[model samples]
Target chain A: MIERIESFRRRRPRLLEERVTLAHGAGGKASAALVDAVFVEAFRNPLLEPLCDGAVIDLPGGERLVISTDSFVVQPRTFPGGSIGQLAVHGTANDLAVSGAVPQWISAAFVLEEGFPIAELKQIAADMAAAAAETGVQIVTGDTKVVPKGAADGVFVTTTGVGVIPAGRDLSARSVRPGDKVLLSGSMGDHGMAVMLARGDLAIEADIRSDTASVSPLVESLLAAAPSTRWLRDATRGGVGTVCNELAQACGLGVLLDEEKLPVRPMVAGACELLGIDPLYVANEGKIVAVVAAEETEAAIAALRSHPLGADAAEVGEILEEPAQTVVVRTGFGGTRIVDMLVGDPLPRIC
Target chain B: MIERIESFRRRRPRLLEERVTLAHGAGGKASAALVDAVFVEAFRNPLLEPLCDGAVIDLPGGERLVISTDSFVVQPRTFPGGSIGQLAVHGTANDLAVSGAVPQWISAAFVLEEGFPIAELKQIAADMAAAAAETGVQIVTGDTKVVPKGAADGVFVTTTGVGVIPAGRDLSARSVRPGDKVLLSGSMGDHGMAVMLARGDLAIEADIRSDTASVSPLVESLLAAAPSTRWLRDATRGGVGTVCNELAQACGLGVLLDEEKLPVRPMVAGACELLGIDPLYVANEGKIVAVVAAEETEAAIAALRSHPLGADAAEVGEILEEPAQTVVVRTGFGGTRIVDMLVGDPLPRIC
Candidate 1:
């Protein structure tokens, strides 16, 4: 690793222009490039080679451990239906869950600004505790650091989770096949729309609530029903469209999403329309995109729908052999258009 | 856990003032109270009951896992001899190492402010990679988030580490006995003073460099020489004084430190005198406090001195049976003074 890092340092290829932009955090091309150039290049390792949502480690005891992390810098700390605390817990738990790991322990670290409200902090803690209990995970350890007022936004929470993946359950984007069926575990754009509305940045208002709930239970049901699931990922920062693109690229396959079949709440859809944002590119906290064998699609959907968080689950897409490494959305008007990752963040700090 | 949280909420004792003050994060009385009221009261679990530097879990295969997390919000991203990235890695690794765990995997989550320099980010990542390699730990998985320029100070790195504790090697503050010897790995105040100089906050300037190096090797040496080592901790955010307080409270014992035995660099001592700050309260990223049986004190110090990071290691304090849960410092002028925890953060975001 030292030799690899030294080799890169010797080249010193000007990786970025000068300053980091919002696009760098948009979970798009820019984000990928930043990660590859700065992090992956420096800390190259087999566990991180897959570039999956989480890293899988094999313990000496023949147990597989999956670890994932996320930092929540959502605006308005408290949003409709949930707060940053809930998002922090659910985000990492979902990441591990989607990786075929049974979420177990989580560590939360908070960077708080001085003069923040103690009452609000307590409320956030309560939200985190409730989310952990509901997901059957324990918040085992934590750290808190306070910065002077103005040095940081109200509060930012980073949660890192560890879970155990049962033997024989190997979930990865590389397992995706050309004939795989794509499953959407619930509606799109709910989390982003809800946060945007709560921020009141736009004059438009809607009765939208974030689908901020843990997807672990839903994942358990899906895995039990469709043991041949190829890949799984939560539609987070860059949303379902971005996830499809990542999956397609990872497997060198094409994805075709039927626009008419995409699950989206009416309120979220209306807000996306008003904001001129594609629902497919808006984040959803309590949603997932699963790729399963074509033969198991029905069972997967059935299992997902059996869970409250996935009641709106649907088979929205399928993998195609042609147009490799791309995502095309079939329009309601019988037309098709390529769906690319967002170039820049439409709603900064939405989650 | 749910019932406990509900019971606390029902009381509504107004545990804290409306707003969070710097004291709440000083790792002192206020910080303890805040954690007890907000986090401990909510996420009550067996693993978290000890409230030690890290949480220990028993893996199914008879292996014990220690997990710890810390967020680096240092004022200056780059300080003399080290950077926030190095601190992030060493900080978490030391937490696990002191817990008698062989540091293994670490996950880092970064929160960057928009418009931050990409070159600086690259340097930080490189620093982290070097630190990880030096510490024999792998950077497995990570996440990155960006906030608008003013929303965050610059960059805050949160690292969560996981390690495996060898069989029958239990290290905890609760294990400290009345006849224990407290050994200091090296000098104090170097890290805090170096960061202060980097920030250019005060008119006084000192030629001090942070002792920001991994302490795992030193810990290995000590453990080998003195298998009876009872407790270990890195003197970090709140410094050795704060750690002493916590250790005393956790074990229901008193700690006595000889002022003459305390090691401090000439530059740091001069700076501390100018600023009217006690060196004991200054943070040390690369130093550690090991509590070993009185009979093993000589061997522990000898072993520590064999390592580069612990060249200046010395037995500076001892555990006492009387004055349980208190810390006293013997003055060079033939007097003793209570070394109470700081009421407020003298150096906020010092990491």
Candidate 2:
């Protein structure tokens, strides 16, 4: 059903629900529908048409810059490995980094609920500052707003980042070819499982921490080694499966993955299996899915493995020409099945 | 006390509250204390030291860019003159404009409640699009996150804008001199009073609508006519009185205001008097406070009056050399009193 860009823009979104649900923000089919129908249709412009993780703009002075924004509303505020503040910084910076830009400056906006403790707010701010410092970006400007008690959760942080794209470096999903190989930075489902366990609702438990981190170092190393990489995307809310599906749809190609080759930590796999969830659909904050030229696979994997964040990097998939706009997975039992975008929110507020 | 920039940085914020209150977000003394103690102290850097509405960055290629962010949490998403969506766009864009930049791009982040109606969201998006188009800015990148029903009120939008600042132009509150004149673009207290009445909590009502609008045209006209303008700021939270107080503190000079010349709509004045609130401390969305060289006062006022939004533009005050960092108002009865930053929020979620 996915074809040329013009046809996609001309297609009207068909939403059946009158009220928004959690599914609409789960970074899956429902989320795409909401964004395309409500936002893309209203703010349709050439710059925003691609719906990439970030928007790339050509300045009047012949320079290119990338801008990305994300809001952190993760439950619990402080997760196992990261707080909303750190996620607020890393999440937006990763968008710019994966877009082949050097993230530089960030703007933070906070929505605080009245009666929230000042001590906790201090810890969050310190975490944000440390994250920004580690990511090599500055929080240059910000705003704060407070609502009455119960109007909002403890606190919500929204960060926007801007970075300059190096000349002659263009990364896009539309460049994926049949022979392009898919590489994942590391294990999946850790972030989602960790957050779920942190919520303390599920009785089943194992030691799993959210991989909330900046993937800039990994991205820089991969780009340096595999200059012919076609595209890169940080596997966030919907994880590797959703990202592959989006790539297939964008390029009118197919993605074929080997389940055995996919990287998943033992604890995360066990938690997902017990919960009846698919590891491929669970979120990972520090992982990236990259498409590279077939010949560059070895070099890319080696470069990724050199970084601590990508120690378990693996080549798990490849592009196909037969089944356009689809993702297929080869089961370890010598069977194959088509994987689709998540229909409902199996795990909400994973990020 | 504000003799040198370094001294301000060395002076630590003294906050007595153990928990954040509504005053911490009211753009007043408590808010300043919180920002200085928590954010400024944690993220101390040269770019963020001034605490300007926006941060100005010099790109590697020598081009100057201004970035600003603001979050909208108005209790009633839909108000008289505009909705939260429009305010999200206009508010951030005005910050860039007052910083002498042409707002070009905006990134919007929405924190939504689970059960918000899709129809309302569509309307809000439409309003945002219209406002961006009218303000000559584009909503280039965006994100949406949904929380469970009670986790958030309805919808909160955080917008960050990037703009280009023309060369040979610099605006800072520290440039004010003893004889510099203060000019206000239009009437005050309309926005806060209108929002207060919109809540239906008060029995007294008037025909006062919010003066929410884009002040880019007015700012441009004033700057073009009077190139010697020292600084400019939009009177948003805490109103014109608070803005003047900030200027006084920043420049280490006293502000002397002529109350008789301060423009106020009859309905707004009546509402403020009935509610025992000072019109000077109430918020205004479209008004601008400008400090200009004494010799160019007439030109500045004339330019401001030329715009429809500035029809009530008036020269209401002047900078003083005595009683440094203080703001004193000469009442119509030949008496004077100190005008301080708002102590607490009289109108919460007024946008």
Q: For model 1, how does the per-residue alpha-carbon lDDT over A1-351 read when each residue is reduced to its tens digit?
A: 121122223323244547888877877666776776888777876644543434788889998898788899998888888999899899999988988999999998888899888888988999999899888898988888888999999999999999999889988766788889999998999898899889876897788899998999999999999999998989988899988887776677899999999988888888888789999999889999999999999999999999988888999999999798789999999999999866668878877
The alpha-carbon RMSD over the true interface for every model, in angstroms, is 3.5, 3.5
lDDT of 2 by residue, B1-351 (tens): 111122234333478899989998998777788887788778876645553434788877777899889999986887789888889899988988898898888989998899999999999999999999889998888888999999999899999999998888888776789999999999999888888999998998688898888899899999999998998989999998888888887777989999999999999999998999999999888889999999999999999999999999999999999778889999999999999888778988989
lDDT (tens digit, per residue) of candidate 2 on A1-351: 111122234333367788889998888888877887788778876545543434788877777888889999998888789888889999999998998999998988999999999999999999999999889998887888999999999899999999988888888876789999999999998888889899999998688889999999899999999999998988888878888887787777889999999999999999898999999999989999999999999999999999999999999999999699889999999999999877789888876
Q: Is the docking of candidate 1 incorrect, acceptable, medium or high quality?
A: medium
Q: How does residue B23 of candidate 1 score in lDDT? A: 73
Give the least accurate 10-residue stretch of model 2 chain A, judged by summed lDDT: A1-10
DockQ in order: 0.54, 0.58
Tell me the lDDT of model 2 at B160: 93
Which lDDT tens digits does candidate 1 get at residues B1-351? 121122223322234667888777766656666776888777876644543345788888888888888899987888888999999999999888988899999999999999999889989999999999899998988887889989999899999999999898988666788989999999998998899888886898678998998899999999999999998888886788988877776677899998999999988999999989999999898999989999999999999999988999999999999788789999999899998765567787787
Error of 1 at A158 (Å): 0.7
Residue B83 of model 1 has an lDDT of: 90
